[model samples]
Target: MELSPVLLYGEAEGMVRSLQSFPLRDTGSGGWLKQHEYIEKLNMQAILNASAGQEEMIKDLLVTHGKVSSLIRELITVEIWKQKVFPVISQLQDFQPRSTFPLYMVIHHEATIINLLETILYHKDVCESAEDLVLDLIDYCHRKLTLLLSRCSAGEIAGQDRLLPSSASETSSLEELKLQAESLEFDVALKCLSVLRYITDHTDSLPLSITTRLLNTHNLPCVLVELLHSCPWSRRSKGQLQKFESGRWLSVPAEDQQKMTKLDGQVWISLYNLLLRPECQQKYNIDGFTRALISSHRDPHRSAAEPSGATAISQLFVSERTGAPKEGADLRAGSRSLGLHYQREFWEMEGDSEAPGEACVLPQ
Candidate 1:
């Protein structure tokens, strides 16, 4: 006999009701059923089945795995945190993919992740597990930025692009190099700050490692300085633009060096701009840093200043640790400067103390 839709529905309903009233003293009620053993069984089955497709399953499996694993990891992380498990961040961090997805995806995810990570880090006391998540997020961002930066031409690619845009002929000139410096832009603000901070934190290595690299690498120093200068981290160079032209050497008297060594107003200003980066200020111990100045090999144009630019020629870039840069605040004003602007906004509003501007060294 054929079943009617109503009869099938009625039977299904009755069966559902019957099944729902379970604890009807079932047969399998009593053993030492290892609570989550069943759960492990199901997950293992799914993982095994998913693995059958290999890399093709990576996207889907990783998604599912990330959810489940992240959930478990998070629970453990919380427990660890509750116990003040500060040391576990490194361990938890190790679970994340050492590398990340493509640059576009990374850039897309960065801000959201950063904000989330920031919240987690802020909960250092209440939820120590959050620190691991934050550290992992930072590592992911660093890897993404590193990859993107590698794909990029260099720090001065922006300048070069502007000089020639795409013309091969444009690359051979110093003007093109200067333009390369002008065009550098960051995919992430924090990453830019991180780079600047790295330099300042490692100020002691300036003349030795950084200086040598700066002199040897094309437009990297200018690119880095420009990144810091243009942000809210410090002051920007103004007078230094006069040096951007490639042939500035011809204009200088025969004896003067190409790079300057005068710890002029701008030089100090630039140093201060570099100093304010939280990475540098927060991470570095400037006390023991010593930058041995080798004046002879250095250019006469700019001062063969100390590698640890802790000292100020003019106090313009210097800040009084607790607050922002003070106007004419013991800082000598000079036209030629070396610092980058760190303020997000281009200019100060009226009555707000103006950032004493300085000249930036343009790289042509």
Candidate 2:
């Protein structure tokens, strides 16, 4: 009987090369996000092939999507766990506290490379078993995102070009993830608690390197804060110097790193808890949400969620620079913003009456 070649006999590589080498044409209009995602899927397939003891195959994969940073990160992260890593992870967790932070961060980052590994585990594309590996990948993203947010404040990733946005939908998703993380009833990781809080409070005050990398992800110029820092300070204009401009990492002086860490991560936890509670649901009305947030400290005065009074900016954080004073005076003008913001908008519109009444979801 004919058997498969011990090595590749033009079965996988030769068959797939044509699809791999074709230059993509400009497809107008429809969000090519799907196209890119498909490309990523193919790229991931190449990576899986490379893992099957084929360096040349991996090289081919790299050549196709070398410039895609996300793809590269996912690829590297997934590829790092050929052997058992759980014991190594536990070792890092138990090591010296200061070093443990960075070490675990590394492990988590590597493990979380493939965000959709869970969904793709059952996919028939890869010939080998990937269940154990895919679960590990999801575990890594959760671990890293949680640890980095908990241990390092926005200060670390905030200033970085590749910095993740503090308000990213993923932060909200993390709150939901907590339910799943705890579904097993294992002791929920304290790091998870800290990171959730930080995300909710919008605390991006991490180390300069981390923050810079995180910010860099948003395509903001890396030197933005630096340029602000280098702005000349004058005797006459002394008050204009600000936190970021002045290179102050934290928006305001904090009691301690631990306190800031807890506060920053708790916002989402609280939001999630409130959202899941029946008490919040009873009063949840679309039109009143903005106002309810503004007057959150008090109970609703009416059936509506927000109090019957005019709204306040719930937490709009802005540094205000005022007029200069005398020497040793408060001349360094600046305002430091932190936490959630409060905004109120009132609008009057005149338009064609085809659609007459605007829908307003009033609190019951």
Candidate whose lDDT is highest? 1
Query: Residue 104 error for model 2, in Å?
Result: 21
lDDT of 2 by residue, 1-364 (tens): 3432333524434433332211122121133333333444444554454334334443343234332233333443333431244335444543434333333333333223232232122122220222223223224434444443342333332221121355334544333322323221111222223322222122122223322222232211111122112221111113331222111223333232112122222322233222222233223332344334433433122235533221221221100112224321321111011111110011111112322123211111
Cα error, candidate 1, residue 212 (Å): 23
Q: What is the lDDT of candidate 1?
A: 0.30
Candidate 1 residue spans exceeding 4 A from truth: 1-134, 154-364
Q: Which parts of model 2 are misplaced by more than 4 Å?
A: 1-135, 162-364
Tell me, by TM-score, which candidate is best: 1
Candidate 2 is scored at a TM of 0.21
Q: Where does candidate 1 have its weakest 10-residue lDDT segment?
A: 288-297
Give the Cα error of residue 315 in candidate 1, in Å.
Answer: 8.8
User: Tens digit of lDDT per residue, candidate 1, span 1-364?
Assistant: 4222222334323322322111212212332122122223333333333334222221232233333234233323322332343233224534443332222121222232222222222111212232233233323433433433443434322212233456737454333322332232222333323333223333332233333332233222233333323322221143222222221112333353233322122223334434443333343232221121211122123445532223342132234443554553443222122232222122231112435342122111
Q: TM-score of each candidate?
A: 0.24, 0.21
> What are the Cα lDDT values of the candidates?
0.30, 0.28
lDDT of 2 at 220: 14
